[model samples]
Target: MATPVRVTRLCRLVGRTVSSPSARHRQAVSLPARTCFISTTTWKNLLFKLDERTAHSSLDLFKKDTGVIYRMLGLDPTHVQDNPERFRDWAVVFGNERISSGRHYWEVTIKKSQEFRLGVAEAAMSRDDCVGTNRCSWVFSYAQRKWFAMTNGKTVPVTLVGKPDRVGILLDYEAGLLGLVDIENPRIIHAFKAQFKAPLCPAFGLWDGELLTHSGLEEPEGLK
Candidate 1:
């Protein structure tokens, strides 16, 4: 059976602080390229910024809990009630940038890693849905001392050599691949391949503990 997931939690509480945002809903940052690449096993050097889409109305609880005055004040209560993008049963944040082409690399460090999910989702991914449960998203999740690669409502168990403090994500957009790496041990935990159809946003879900993002980084030399 596919592992049932609840996209809810403390609601995306950890990330670098940003300036107070406007009341209007924020959109994904546009990418410069649209051409996909031919599939290749060789990785390329890439760097990209990764910032949380902090204006989300669904993250009010997180703001309140963390006492981030800026975010608390920035909450659009009106939008919370009617915003089509507001998540009713789940809480996650997407990166401000979108990926439509080229290769991209980033890593997330898990602090008190109890239960968290990280991966990519199309910009149009349903606010009411969970990542990896639909065609529009793919993820690597760790929960209950177990790890799995999930997408399209299917789950594949991932066996690791040891607990990893950081997980690396490699997205080959045109080549259609998503890989999760065990940074400490320098090994791939799992990878998913597909013909990506739309621009993707970095997506994260956390219930307890923190997931810190490290972006605009060199692709790990060991993974090359």
Candidate 2:
């Protein structure tokens, strides 16, 4: 019989910090790239900005204790609700618009938390299915002092020289490409080639008491 996996809510106490360079480096340095074809030139040419208005109303919080009050950044106050029973395993939120074609880009700022998962998911994906576990989602997750791409229940470890404070995502649905970029240096952290069958919504996942803020769209310096 397959080993049973225990599921727990994605909640944690607020105000914890993950800023030790030694810790970040120790976690990310040993992972190997899942995809080996990333090029810096390609990333610069495809730069696109995030559409902040599309930020999701609900996000999964990664806390273990019940009755813990936490803030959901980028969500409207009226839509926020308290649900102690709903926190479990993974917390996810979706971008408002769907990407059916063309190249689009967005950026997210990681302020307080050290670990997170971000990528694109099919609009029809089940709420119960965490991003990167199924064919419908293409996710890049950072946790346990490592970075990796998750898809079809498999992990492709990614290596990076430094931890990124801001992350940029590029979805070239027409070309079947998805990329993760480090916004400060503007370098490609990882990229994937997949056959995306349905319209994709930008997705976010939070665990480990991290705070993520959506930095609205900004035209690439030369694109405007």
Candidate 3:
């Protein structure tokens, strides 16, 4: 098992939360979980897992998939600006997958994005609040050429040896751990130790560029 790494020296960032959700917002929240998947030749690969043999033998673990790819579609592009479920005035969205047990791993390709936040948040987290700015979520964010680990309005600066193009996320629900990895550089960015009390969905907040998700991945050897 991978050991949990605790984030330290956190300082509070200014934030706000909405106590009550509107009826339309509540309705949108009730929509069934939607996951995006693309196929090449075979398989209905919305989400995937590796077979024992391939998983045990692979060195290029992140790129090698079992003929399937899972993607995350953020929101209705036409209605994104007016979307009631958007996080306050920000462009934030959550993936449909709700994780409550065992271990899970996924990656997000940050394509030309100048500012973005990626991580997990409780399904019931307030849409009016930003991810990692409250107790219900945890995230690793990049803005203005700086990196941070944030939760509950607290932010911790992250020092990285190399820039990240693709980020790896590892969630061990039972262990109450959330780890963020820098894939290109093969190093851990930060890990938040928490007593997760509810099911979590992949949460993201983006400003300028695209965020592509690659799911159904095995935990990286370095994380182990």
Candidate 4:
């Protein structure tokens, strides 16, 4: 007979402060009731695709010939002056697979870009909604030479010294833990622990002549 999975729910409190480049300060807020599950079995990476239907402000971005990578031009001053609202912020794309439970991992290759956002969002999130700015999503963004983790419309600075060419994401759904890892050094850059209330989909945000490539799914070194 197979062993049963165990689910654990506890009241969890998490807090952090957000700092802006202009020396602005935001207070730390607390999250509650995080859920976790204990599992001994190894989890494998799941294959994913960029869902065009769920993307926002991405009419101009182009997918490369490989079909696994997407590219977009950097912000243009001339275009911004003519139409400020159209391309003022990041363009977003979401993964097709929605994860409700179990542990999963994936990698993204970001090339020659200074700004980008990578993470997961609720499966039901609106096509027009921006990830990391709402309660249903958790994201890590790099902009202006700084890194930040955003949730519930709040942004918290993530302290890391180096920029990574590739980023790895590990989502322990039942354990309610999200981790962002550096592929080159194999070190965790940041981890967000919270009670995920809904199914999650992989998400990416890009702008400023950035090319974001999805590596599909591959088992990490020892997990296989």
Candidate 5:
């Protein structure tokens, strides 16, 4: 197991909970048991045992059937896609595939906002299945044979059927495969102005979805 980096301690705000500075050094530190709010930095800060053979063996299976991996996580990963552009702004979409074990199981550093919008079929089948390098984010449109770099909400379209398989796989890792499909908010004001602005507007205060709770487990309509 990889040792965690010194977790920064935050102050306890009226509406927030924070760790004591000493909590960082507590052996078997007590964190919320039912939460999934793991930081990406945590993964990068730690290391685990993963080699080329492990990833290579799983690549074919993931390319052929990612659902099996999804099932392993006990998540019902049906084909659900949400277009970020449809709602406007920096929308981020992701799809999940098998990743390495522990520590850096997945390394997704999305400096730019993204929209989760494709599926295994869309990602794996497309020649441009992978678009941008893990160094940055990218967009993919399987049907249109379109792929491009997405940074700072700016898009750069590209057509690359000539890249190596490593590019596609790594891109997929950098871009989290679509996690939970229905868990989303309409980012575009115009997308739902008429429908949501009325008296019957849906709760717009807190995001309503499956997010990490104070504890570290999955729950319906996660922590408020």
Candidate 6:
């Protein structure tokens, strides 16, 4: 979904994504507005320095196997993952910044996207979101602790919507723009903000019209 041309085009037109992020693109490379401030030293973190190393690592992810990642579109996983060129169009809006107010920039993005088209769900936590609209998406059920991804369209960006440094991850199904948390037991769909868990099944495919079936989706087979 992300290409160098696309990333640049979106960055130029869409501008910043996260409603409120620690590190932000400023008109003047000085500091963010006071209302955008979190603390006195917040500027230090907000104004994150995008060094070559950090930039390199983010790019590396696109090349690495990252078995945990699953690209539903392209029909093949290698099309996105293991292919750095695919992500060139994407810009690291937030490399690693702390948001004292919102649920980190990633979470903020998840929330915003969810509100715009979809929503987040987690039983323990009220609700969380990550990743936004994708070219496509296909929802499915979790059966184990294995990482997962899906699509409802031709392609959708699946992003990890967890805090900068925390476990208990979930996928922001951009195609569907839905925040889906993996139920510890794999058979529960946790509500994003309700912090409540509901019993689900491993074969619980997304609702298809008035019917429930795994019709147009495939399992997250990870890297080749």
Best by TM-score: 1
Question: lDDT value for candidate 2?
Answer: 0.55
lDDT of 6 by residue, 186-210 (tens): 3213322122122110111111111
**C-alpha RMSD between model 3 and the true structure:** 11.0
Candidate number that wins on TM-score, 1 or 5: 1
Whole-model Cα lDDT of every candidate shown, in order: 0.62, 0.55, 0.59, 0.58, 0.20, 0.21
- Candidate 4 vs candidate 6: the lDDT winner is 4
Supply candidate 3's per-residue lDDT for 200: 77
lDDT of 1 by residue, 96-162 (tens): 5667777788887775557777899886676556667678889987877878777777777777755
**Best lDDT goes to which candidate?**
1
Which regions of candidate 1 are displaced past 4 Å? 1-82, 222-224
Roughly what TM-score does model 5 have, to 2 decimal places? 0.21
The per-prediction CA RMSD against the true structure, in angstroms, equals 8.3, 13.6, 11.0, 12.6, 21.6, 19.9
lDDT of 2 by residue, 21-112 (tens): 34234221112222322233444333222222222233433322111113444344345442321212245555545566667677766655
**Superior by TM-score: candidate 3 or candidate 6:** 3
**Candidate 1 weakest lDDT stretch, 10 residues:** 63-72
CA error at residue 119 for candidate 1, angstroms? 0.6
lDDT of 5 by residue, 14-118 (tens): 121122235244222122222222244443422221111111111111222211111112211122222211111111122322222221211221111121212
- Work out the TM-score per prediction: 0.67, 0.60, 0.64, 0.65, 0.21, 0.19
Better of 2 and 6 by lDDT: 2
In model 1, residue pairs whose N, Cα or C atoms come closer than 3 Å (at least 3 residues apart or on different chains), thus clashing, are 37-174
